[model samples]
Target: MIDALPPLREVIETHGLSAKKSLGQNFILDLNLTSRIARIPGDLSGADVLEVGPGPGGLTRGLLAEGARRVVAIEKDPRCLPALAEIAAHYPGRLEVHEGDALEFDPRLLNGPVHIVANLPYNVGTELLVRWLTPKVWPPFWSGLTLMFQREVADRITAQPGGKAYGRLAVLAQWKAEARVALTLPPEAFTPPPKVHSAVVHLTPRPEPQFPADPKMMNRVVAMAFGQRRKMLRASMKAMTPGIEDVLVEAGIKPTERAEQVPIEGFAALSRALTARGL
Candidate 1:
């Protein structure tokens, strides 16, 4: 984890950076740990990396030291600009820090096939993932995603059918990508430790989806089905459009089946069938 730079604690002190509860910031002051996280994406030497919320540039430094070709980092907090500038100067054009909210920024601005690696802000983690995953295009802007989230959310993202954790997130994540929990960290790892443990999730875009279906309808169908997860599909999806039972039958899913019991393929099939019916 040792590089030619000063330690993260010194950098934080020098920059006068402190964790902000409103922004969901928990600065990880350990460069050794940050370096380990940076390597999670594996050989970013040829990759254009995009990092969200690079507070004090701890992980940004790690990414550069770990051989990322270039990093386009988006950070909303203006206070960390000075510290990030120092890291950029040290790396000499290897890093570019943008002052903006990642929630509204355009990933298309970065180079093709970007790799998103981050210790995400807790408050907006799932919202960002939904935006990235539900893009209009078949293949997304990013080629790969290695992100940190609460352990509970990680379980939900990688969950499968017929499990307590399985639901809308599980469907959307696994439908078009391969996702898994790569690493787990204790609460004490952060500057001001969060209440729950954190986990690192690695996701790679699939060359093809689980099945062919209209993207908008696929998401809508899945949302409606899981909207009342405890109820049978025939009842839960009734309000989305008419002929709910027929749609399930066309998809080869039983009308009596609940949302949690249906696989991703089933949802895709349902969406395709619904689109065909022009409903």
Candidate 2:
């Protein structure tokens, strides 16, 4: 909390940095708020933190102030580098800034258990989240994710079956991880307010999936079901494996059920049943 470095506004002005709509950037200049966000990932006493799209490094400063052992920040906009560099100089070896696209940047390059927390760019937020959700390994490489998404997307992630927001995203998120809406940020919190409010979601990977099913089969079942969401399972799954109705019965899912009405466990069960039949 005792960062003697220049104020973020001065840093932004000095670097000629302006939030860009094209890059989906919305800078948060408030140090107090940023610090609060940094603490959301729990006690960072000696944790390795991964941050994305750190425009002007407001959250980066917060992270260091809150005691992150090491922070690897990925920034695509070169304009923000000078501001981030200033913070790096102040914090010494605690901060590392990488100039590249976050989507292409790999977290495995850094050592230790990573706690990814960021005010992610709006445009690529959902896609990035999906990539993190479906990592090659179970229990994921990162210990957890504390991410900011448009509130609507957050709703979709934490949404349950039978809710309008429930779909493939909800199924995938809830099945493999324990996710919840941790906080909500009004549009005014950003430099250039977006049309909708933002939400912070915390997802802790489950040691084991809520139910057992092959990843590929589970994803395929989820995609097909939600893709044809409006249709019942018997009708929608017609294009999928044959004998779908029998599997639904075996999985204890109603053949007449629609995608939105199916629970995560049911989908996993149905996927296991389907794959077991060699379908």
Candidate 3:
């Protein structure tokens, strides 16, 4: 046992915390796996970690046991609150449990240099990642992110150009941070195994984007290019501006290239070219 607290299974049973499919809950009862995830972001001794959807507090306990300076857990399910409260009691002031939607909670309330680590709820994982990556500021509030997602989603985040998985997600994530799939977890790792496999992704924010481009324009350009990915850039991005071919030429991207054929740098170039034209 990592602490005097009862085993996770016992705690879940005691609290009547059954995994809720509606909420996208698949509790990780294994302390070892959770601890391993906690350690992925390197030493947490000096970082305040933000955890979302900590069903039954399994990852929350791991975060505390692994010596995170402080852990702020946001749980949407009210039934899991008691289990998390027990963990908070075990660790004293190290853990804070908030019962609310993670999407609604703001991370800016937390102090600087925070590291966000979580086995994010499946339903909200991608949306949350996008939100974190596209904040108004260049450098987001959290210094690093260690997040778990469905294998397919993980592939999209870390995928390179010219692949089916490489699209808006790949462009957005890779443009904003250094992303890679750090670990793969089998379906059986959770209490109720999901149909698909899961993988953990580690991302460290770049002080500034690898290439210069307006974030809003970049998103617009990427979305349009990938919206009709089967079409060449000349056809798909024609609506972006009247002089679409000129924009592609200015950015050094071939008009015949598909969205998947363009790398992050190429997309950023397109965005910059559009901005330069006062679009």
Backbone clash numbers for all candidates listed: 0, 0, 0
- Write the residue-wise lDDT of candidate 1 on 197-236 in tens digits: 9999999989778789888898899898888999999999
Q: Write the number of the candidate with greater lDDT, choosing between 1 and 3.
A: 3
**Segments of candidate 2 deviating more than 4 angstroms:** none
What is candidate 2's lDDT per residue for 163-264, written digit by digit as tens?
889999999999889999988999999888889999999999999888999999999999999888899999998777677898898999999999999999
lDDT against true structure, model 3 = 0.92
- Candidate 2's displacement at residue 114, Å, is 0.9
TM-score of each candidate structure, all chains considered together: 0.97, 0.97, 0.98
Residue 251 error, candidate 1, Å: 1.4
Residue 136 of model 1, lDDT score: 78
User: In candidate 2, how many Å is residue 89 off?
Assistant: 0.2
Best by the lDDT measure = 3
Residue-wise C-alpha lDDT for candidate 3, range 1-279, written one tens digit per residue: 777788899988999998999998888888988988988999989989999999888888888999999999998889988888888888899988888998899887687679999999899999999999999998889899999999999999999998999999999999999999999999999889999999999999999998999999999999999999999999999998888998898899999999999999999999999999999
| 2 or 3, greater by TM-score | 3
Q: 101 in model 3: Cα distance from truth in Å?
A: 0.8
Clashes of 3: 0
